[model samples]
Target chain A: MSPKGPAPSSVVREFIKDIVVDNRFCFSFPAETSALNKSVASFGVINPVWIVKSQDNRKTIVSGFRRYNAARKAGLETIPALTFKAGREYDLFIAHVAENTAVRKLNVGEISRVIFCANEHFGHGFEKISDRLFDALGLERSRKIYDMLLAVAGYGPAAKDIVSAGMSLKAAYRLARFEPDQRETLCKWIMDNRYGTSKSSLMIDMIDDIQAVKKKSVDEIIADAEAHVSPDMEKPQRSSRLFESVATMRNPILARMRRDFQTALESLNLPPSVEVIPPNNFEGRHIEFVIRARDRSSAISSFKALSKVAEAESENTESSKLSGLFGWI
Target chain B: MSFPGFSKILIAEEAVSTPLTKKAKAAWPDIAPQIVRNLADHELQLDMEPDPVAAGKRTLALGPNRGKFIRKCPGTMGLVCCNYWVIDLVEGCPIDCSYCILQGYLTDRRIRLATNINDLVDEIDAELAGGTQPVRVGTGELSDSLILDPQLGLAETLIDIFRTRPRATLELKTKTANIDSLLNLEPADNIVIGWSVNTPAIISSDERGASNLHDRLAAARQIVKHGWKVAFHFDPLVLHDRWEEGYRRVVDDIFSVAPPEKVAWISLGAFRFHPSLKQVIRDRFPMSDILNSEFVLCPDNKMRYVKPERLKLFRTLKNAIVAKAPSTPLYLCMEGIEIWESVFGGSPRGDKNLCQVFG
Candidate 1:
């Protein structure tokens, strides 16, 4: 069967106070009104609010909560509104949700609120409500993605904004589990520095793992990172160094072994064409040496240079330093 | 038994007459068996529950095997195989270790009793009838062999089949000390009672429902005295603080009671798992620190400690085991040939007996 649209309503002017303003069904983030106050004061309620009659024939406001709230602050006596016939409260809630979903450029906070309240207002199963809202948002059907989005409706203001600005779920999952103060500090720092998703994600992952391992607070970790980074360094370089520090903090032994390997590799100072590469995390037994020679003769020359190094006294060689990598557990 | 049995028993209408069903009904008398027309429909409801794995552990279903009962073990891809065969006697184990792969693999969490053990025995009897080489068949691959043996007496039937076959060895691996029925039975060969052992910390932390280290070793000692061969599996060697001392103590305790001649084999496997199981473990065991360690994707697509750390852990434990008992045969489970060589000083193929099963 084809789906039916909401019932029709007529526009009329009603006293802002007389219209029993019950907004439990409204789909929105926690109400903040600076922007709405400025817009309503300038535009003078360009569009009418939507309302319906309650059980006892009292009019109830359905949508345009921000506009009505702003009008109250602006000291308006009567507000223009669309009055639907009685007993269409649920229908009006869904229609307003659809209109908001289709028309508004919603932030993640707004999107999450819409999804959360739509399920609540309609009393539908979370799965069904989430499916409709995810379709409205044009998101992929990932497991628990809808649930996580719904959970965002409860986050602090800064965290919601960070998610709105495009932090990946991969990063947000870690950030969600952090203590509220830690989450807010990281979110506030991300907002203040205007770190994009990739940088924000790396910050969450590295810092979370480091603090878990070192038993350090986020404040101390951040302070340590900033103090160690030179003041004159650029923001990107600072971030890079901060990440390295946390990486080292999470795996101290591996980090030290990696430094020793690099130093030993540098001491050899092989021919230009020959480059030594350590296995990822020094986990494997083999150390790869790539020869990027320009021609056959250069390749032969690079091989001869390596042979010369091998011919040197075994004590002078750095092969023993390579063994140090395996010693770390 | 240290573990609580099933909360509810689900029996297929046709399978209600099976001896295993009657045994489960008798064991948990408070939980009356509900005749189910379609077990799959009931299992799907488990997916909708908040915790399907936990729900499956509490529910027991007795039914016929929809397919053959015996199959080759699906060893990790790109890793060495032990050529182990498995019997799906029970589809799930009650000993719910936090890192058990069954949590992710068994979508239907119900402890499905393969009620048609008669058919399973007959099928195994045919498979082992003609083989000259010893075929290592085990019921513990998918489910513990003795978790229900106190009530079901399932091991005796399998022992009857394996004891008569000269070329077959049956392993009843478990984390529980439920070996009462096995002790009274006639002494038999080609039957190894294996226990999956871990340190005290791991046992208390992760393996909440299984037997403790002392109890498991005591059970092994009991079986050893009965003239039955015993095996020890230190599989999934989880890395933890002071793990070296913990594992060394376990090895010392095992040798102090279990003679090396009674040992069928000792296999060492480092903790490794599919990446997807990480979240399951985290959610089920919120306080567990296992997932906090540094892991990398190995060639088999399973997340494991980096190769160097694995080598270090294996070498440390190998030295401890050798110091206590050098003559006992040792092999690496689901590891590369290089790891086998590094841990045992040679590949599985290098030893004549190891070549039969682990080559």
Candidate 2:
């Protein structure tokens, strides 16, 4: 490579270094010559070009791909250049990541994959990254970058390309949250780009919400999400172990008290001034639950039912959860 | 209503002192038993007398003298009927505004008391039918109009009634942050949302239980955003030690959320009250700075700043208002013809009537 070293200042050439092209870099010039010829004719290159030198002393284009192409079209042979720093392959990969990450408009998913590759190449959790570098890069930017990397690593390869191509991070994260079998149904839909960012965003919000539900088993959570997304989808195949656990859950105390509450609500014979909606079990938009009564008198009667339920439940746990549930707070 | 009736109340009160029923003991916890016992006694006495003399329907027991509608403006002040109407939405206010007459007149300190709203709306329907002239009506006098509205759905109910009535314009004046129920309802222009606002310092100390100035203006901004015209009242403008800074902050904050066009009118009235109110205010608000000031009695027998003090405070506040919203019409709530001319150089008479003044 002619003892490859930093270009001497006296060289008659450009000063910039070549930009490495890989899956990591998303934006690029067309790989053609006609457009380059048109560009060099219109305006001289505003900045110096960069190129990688091949073994045996031949210079290869590394950075400034567009300028290199234009210079070639204009019949320029010797382009300006700076030498790439010698380092391990992974170190070079990280250098590429650092460069692309600093670009303002870099897509979050692409940055995520670069970080993922770097993390796989280097061993460290994202949180362990230096705070100084994080602050300089920006917390939100780094967070997004780490979140994308976590997503691709968490979801396998096919999903990674779909996400890196402009799908919302939240949707990708949600799809990754699913079991491999459940996620298979979405693979075709995502790769085809049939789902827009908004729909995927909604799915992501719904997934996070469903995953947070307490007292509901995995089957119940999946069932609820399926009910919302596509009602026509048949129930997923469940083994006997999951079914046995669900069937074994029993709270006769709560059941008996709930029945009593319903009886009280019915007997109140409330005036038309009052309207009652029975207590519902499903997750609601705001309130987790609502116990309806026909009138103020019946509502009071329902409180008695609540008292009984609370007393019975407390007999088992001796905790104040039931009392707090009744607005004791 | 009689002294023996009070003795009978003592006997009934004693009856409730007995241990609560097993039902009550089981349903309620330790304090609930006591509450239930007391509730039983109160309910018995309330049933025996069902109607108190003070509880009956009455209107316009207190307010400034009324002027003919046509003399001030081309049309009647109210949107539906010719004349003014009373909206007894609630009878008592828990919020302690410095200028509130409740400190003077009210004997109770209860919250969430209703004003027989069902009956009030019926009476309003009858009065608006009394004349072809539109009746300008408002509540907020007996109590804050929207303080209990969210829980009671009172705003929704009132808006429902007024939406259908073209001649009746109901003004809901409040200094509360309770506005969620009202925002969802389609309040017609016939309804003007009013806010009684003062400086944050006044709100923090004097107006106990009322929302702060920012919250009040935010509620007003929300009402305006939802297409309701708003009004501001600087009534009972107490000249506390830091009155100027307090008033300027209030004026600046109000303009942040609202513009001149969104405001229907701004009413300014120096703190004036009947002499008897001073003792009641002292007893109720022991720490009130409002009662610490010097005042003189006018011919109306109400206390106000001596003419010069009133002029100075009014001029300074008027400047702030003009600076914030130059185009909004400003009026004196209960000032006389001379005081009106002295401050704003005009009265709620002549070609400039209250309706046109609002526009």
Candidate 3:
């Protein structure tokens, strides 16, 4: 149904079921929908949802999917929408993207969906879409960005959630390379554990390594990690335990070093007021000694006590032999 | 040299008159050579883009060797250095191993072919003439020794030079099967051709554009058959499942084809690299699991497998090799004295004892 004039001048009331979410701009996170629902329930949708007539005469939403869903949840029978007359498919796609861009910035995944829809529905290739259409739609104009977005778009829903939850684009791309079921489990674990981006990336790498080197299935690896967490532990504790277990499995060397360092520290038997800190990641040669003294006399005593302990321990350890040979100690 | 990654050749005006540049042109006939007054002109073309890695892979620059060609290997202070010297030949590698430190170590990605081989040979000769002590030198430090051998033809020149110097031994280490240039030349007892080997699984997955383990072993056999001493480097030994069995098969494969008497020395080094190489590998080889394993930044600023893990890997491989070839001399490359004591029960006193085996 072509518009008789320009577009609808006034907002038209349409039945909630009659408007279909456009596949091109259908991407939405659960939290986004929940917030929109709360906003609609309290003050109602402040802006009109944009819609266009489809080939079968049903109204398809160009933008404002969260508004329509929230309005439905708010117990509204109809929602305000600006209906447009059917025009060129590309023009319609651009209108959808433009309206969304006008409201707020579209995320990477959302931009990917727009590209996917434009490619599928408008027959624009990635090169054409990235070069010509991206500028017009106010998206970043770069082939690399377009390629990365398209790759992320191919990830399953759970993986998409992981990206939306703050995993980096590079990490998301790596996660997309896994098997569908494995990707879902890993993404779900990341989401459930509330892993930060760096941790999430590390966890993904751990899983990938275990799968490759051990030839274990993703289910088996996840099960092994789950076994490390006790049933009595809460969600956060369980997640932290699982992460530790995975890390141990990934780098048995680091685990052993940490154990060795702990043993070495225990052997020193320093006073409670004296804290000896090992180098971070065992990177530096100098071990930091912190004295928790409130006065100068106590600090001096702590330092003297630490020096005696170190000297005595050095004589007994293999490190002391090297120190003696080099005259370092 | 035929790889599609590099499409252009930029030759320094000074290098255009060198025999090495002439050889490069002869090797790659299809690639029209572009001559510039200096490397700075070529750097101007690269300044337009931010992605040096991508640009480096696409351009091959030829220039004279302005720095010392014979230099000491950068060994860490606390580590037990083997006193290995390096003969700087090329600046980049064509074979794209996932764990290559060159990815992060090199500033740019361009394949830098030094066109001043005569100067390099002269410097090596001078070093050998001035010193009475035995020295071990290798060409695989900055780039693979034989990966570009077919195009450069520097291996024969190096082999001839080391043949006359009794105190100097030359090591040509590579992961490729490009030994056609060396096969027909006279075999020198002082020249050791080594292959960087790993399990078959790693060969297929992580080592891109490299020869498979079977072919590399076959090349080793060919080199030994031609009366040259060969070496095997299970360097960057990966800790995979059934690793004992995988390494056992590799050890068996080596002994079955070539005798241990013809072997020069076997070196073992677990996979290690600069921390930055981890992300580079993740981006370049998404399917690779090499970076997923545990690594700690050692005092030397390189990420290495923990001591226990490295010890276990070394002991296992050492046992497998000893079981097969009891007489073959074995050493650890770029490792600390503690690790040496742990594996061999004692550490080499200095470079003197270390070079005695290979020299």
Lowest lDDT 10-residue stretch of candidate 2 chain A: A278-287
Interface C-alpha RMSD per candidate, 1 decimal: 4.1, 35.0, 5.8
Model 1 bad stretches (over 4 Å): A1-6, A10-152, A165-171, A190-203, A271-275, A293-329, B1-3, B122-131, B356-359
Better of 1 and 2 by DockQ: 1
lDDT of 1 by residue, B1-359 (tens): 32566778888888988777887888888877789987886764374456678778888888889888888888876566888888888888888788899998876778888887778768887787665776888899888888888888888988987888857778899998888898998877789999999999988889868988899888888988888899899987988989999999999999987988888888899998997786678667977777667676666678777666888889988899888778777778888766776777777777775665542
Winner on DockQ between 1 and 3 is 1
What TM-score is obtained by chain A of candidate 2?
0.40
Better of 1 and 2 by lDDT: 1
The candidate maximizing DockQ is: 1
Better structure of 1 and 2 per TM-score: 1
Candidate 1 vs 3: which has more TM-score: 1
Please report, in order, the local distance difference test score of every candidate based on alpha carbons. 0.77, 0.53, 0.77
Candidate 3 docking band: incorrect
Rank all candidate structures by their DockQ, best first, as comma-separated numbers.
1, 3, 2
Once superposed on the true structure, which residue ranges of model 2 sit more than 4 Å away at CA? A1-329, B1-84, B107-116, B351-359
Q: Residue by residue across A1-329, what tens digits does model 3's lDDT show?
A: 78433354378888888877766656555425666779899988778887787678888887678888789888888888887776754665666666667776666566667777777767887667876568755655545556677778787888877677655566666675588878998788778888887888889978877776567887888888888778788888788899999878777666766766666666667778887666656544456667899999888888888788778866778654223312210
DockQ of every candidate structure: 0.21, 0.00, 0.17
Q: Please, what are the lDDT tens digits per residue for candidate 3 over residues B1-359?
A: 46535678899988898888888888778889999887755653342333445566678899987889889887888877777899887887777788888777776567888887888878887888766777889999888899877777788878887888878888999988888988899888778999989999988888877899999999998888888898889988987667789998999999976898888788899998986676677667878877655667787788887666777899999899888777677889888776787788777764343458634
